[model samples]
Target: MMRSLLDHLLIVPIVLPLVVGGAMLLLGERRTRLKAGINVAATAALLATAVALLRRVNAGGVEVAVYLPANWPPPFGIALAADRLSAAMLVLTSIMALCSLVFAIARWHRAGVHFHPLFQFQLMGLNGAFLTADLFNLFVFFEVLLAASYGLLLHGSGPDRVKAGLHYIVVNLVGSSLFLIGVSMIYGVSGSLNMADVALRIAQMRDGEHLLLQAGAAILGVAFLLKAGAWPLNFWLPPAYAAASPPAAALFSVMTKMGIYVILRLSLLLFGDDAGASAGFGSHWLLLIGLITLSFGALGMLAAQNLPRLVGFSAIVSSGTLLAAAGFRSPAVTAGALFYLVNSTLALGAFYLLLELIERSRSYGADLLALTREAFGLDRLQVDDDDDADTGDAGVAIPAAMAFLGLAFVACALLLTGLPPMSGFVAKFVLLSSVLNPGGLTPDVGSGVPASAWVMTGLVIGSGLTGLIALARMGVRTFWAPSGRAVPRLRVIEVLPITALLALCVALTFQAGPAMRYFEAAAAALHAPHDYIRGVMAARQVGATAGVLP
Candidate 1:
């Protein structure tokens, strides 16, 4: 009985938000505080639930816990599976959601009506995406999250946001169309939407069936890659993210990761070593696109004039890094990538929230002043269509406020650039080490290792250096340049979330040994996936609920 009750906890992360979000919708927008309080309680519960699942998964040692929501066995009923990978993602999502929520309460929440409900529903979709084991359900959750994001992205309306939001919507709708088509093809071929069952069918399918499966997989991969913000497919991302509200942008960071997560899950499950003809499918493409995306994001960052766009490109950089790392298909490398994903996400979320407050310090008059001087031929006049106004200003900087901005800015820069004394550095070190030294620490300089590995090495190092240069310039302009800018008042609600996120990164650095061990274990499970298959395929219906649903 106790075990059954514990097993049911798997649904809490998905169900809690859904219930709370629906309730908030009924409350309307007038009682903002009441809605916020409910959101806070519900989000905290999600964090607790995610952590509990993480603990349970860790303690179980390569186990997968499956929750049958309708009390029917899969390939039939809705199945939510919790393994190390899913559990870890749940925890990351909940953490970021919580931080974004707290930060929003300061001001971002009131950007428009239905903020609380939309936010909760966004959580619901995100949680559902991570937890669901069915491809159909994956698409369902994808639409759920994407739909919520449409509202959240446009929560605070402006000319730039409206324009960007339209592009965002059009692109995702196309991706959704592609996603549905791919799922349909796979279902027609395999006759199952359950991921494990699909994998089994793909593994056992004939050569003719293999061709159809591969084609569908390719189509599906595009949608995931686009969502992951890979090169070419990701042009809409930077602008859209830049125009989003700070809290929404923070959560958007993790939303991008959901694409990477699904890509990894499906790529491994359906086309892993067990699938004879399709083994290692799309690996080269993942690696190639990842490297290209990295370069693109780096170049974009170098060219960005304002913090928002800079952070948007930085997000693409993070996405590119994860994709390339996962493309390696080495579990050791995967462990590092997992570590990178968590730490980078924390940094990015903090950076987005920090951008809002930093903007308050910028003097709007400064832009006009620069233009006036240029018109008088006292300064050079040049403006890029894509670039926004400069953050540079000339005036007295306040002592205390400037101090906090400087420190937090430095922390975000360190983490984003993968520099020393922070988790970003640790994540990069793990990635490079795993890639360069799969078995041992030292390699015989260009002997026996693939050229691809070397290229990945160069791209990772180059992007970090590129990011460092870009962030350094933005920092100097925002913090050190002479400023007519006012000292932005810091709110406790606003400041605490950023502090907490960075502190989590610090904690991750300190806890690196244990974290790496856990990631290593997860990587092992992911690569083999025998345990995952058994967990999902062999899931049972509870006695009392069996007849209830049937």
Candidate 2:
């Protein structure tokens, strides 16, 4: 009974949101409070289920759990598998969705006709993408998310959002087309859509088949890279994210991560050292591209004139860092990267939410003043009227709301820049330390760390420095400069979500030891795919054996 219950729990994260979303579509828009209650309840349930699933996997000493939709075998029927990495992702997605939904209820949920339904569907798609064990299902989940995102992107109905949404839709559509073509080619060559079966078949294929598989994999990689916001392929991300409403932007932070998750999963499982000729096929290129993306993100951060775009670029930097670290193929580095991934996503999401509030506090003349200061070489300290006089005393009493916003803004800046005394700092330190000393005190000592690793280390530090400078400049402009603006009024609902996320970051910092251990275990599990394949395939075998007995 317990085993069956746990087995059913594996599918709840994927199914719950889907059912709720369809139900929400049937609810009338007038019942906003009812819809919100249902959405929040469903999200809470999903989070609880994800937590339970993670605990089960950890306590049972099992690395993977497989669920067959119809008790059919893998090559023919759909499969849903859960591992540490996927479970972690599901938990992260659920947390973000719940927080974003609560924040949305304050105002943004009423912005459009189907906000609740679209939001639920988006969660459904994201959960599905993370849990699916087959490449074709992965593509299906991608489309589901992308379609839902198109609606959410334009949820508030603004000119900026509409324009950006159109561009976002067109780009993703093209990527989707490429995704299908790649998956089709792989299916043609290998005669399987199940990832485990594909990996098994690829290992036994002849040289001719190897070339075809590589081409298909490359095309598929391009689609993933585009979604992952890689340097040249991600021009649309910043603008689109910038234009999105706050709640939508917060959720979109995890969307880019879905691409990273898939790439990491496939690259390690299919192209590991055990893949014969394809071993380490694209690792070097991933490292190089990752470094370039990191540099591009840093430059984008420095160039951003507003907070939203800055947060968007921060997402890119996080993605680049993860890709580069994973490219190293070391479990320790991967563990550190996973820790950093969680830290960065939380920090960036919080920053996006906080930015909207901060911007609202700016004076009506703030933009004009900035333009004048830049174009006409006017001094910011000069006073235009007696009411706007600069006291230069530095002893003015700060409003309670302004003080809170300032503190939150500082926390976000520290986290994004990987500064000391925060999770971001600890995450970066672990990653760099792991790269330099993979053996932990023994040190390989013979070959030394690769120059590419050295380059990545420099990029990591360089990006942090760049982010520090950019965020500090913005902070001074927003918080310190005499803008003659009143402190923005904030509601409890608006402030609660941002505070919750920052609190999580602080908690992560204090609990770094145990958190890092969990990620280390996850990375180890990911690197060893045999356990995963065995567990998935054994499920089908057990079902087959049971059928024969009956």
What are the per-model numbers of colliding residue pairs? 6, 0
State the lDDT of candidate 2 residue by residue for 42-107, as single tens digits: 999999999988887777577787888776776678989999899999999988888888888877
Q: What lDDT, from 0 to 1, does candidate 2 have?
A: 0.85
Instruction: Indicate the worst ten consecutive residues by lDDT in candidate 1.
Output: 368-377
Query: Which digits, one per residue and each the tens of the lDDT, describe model 1 over residues 57-98?
Result: 999653788888887777788899989999999999999999
As for candidate 2, its clashing pairs are: none
TM-score for each prediction? Answer: 0.92, 0.93
* Total backbone collisions, model 2: 0
RMSD of each: 6.5, 4.8
Error of 1 at 351 (Å): 0.2
Residue 480: error of model 1 in Å?
1.1
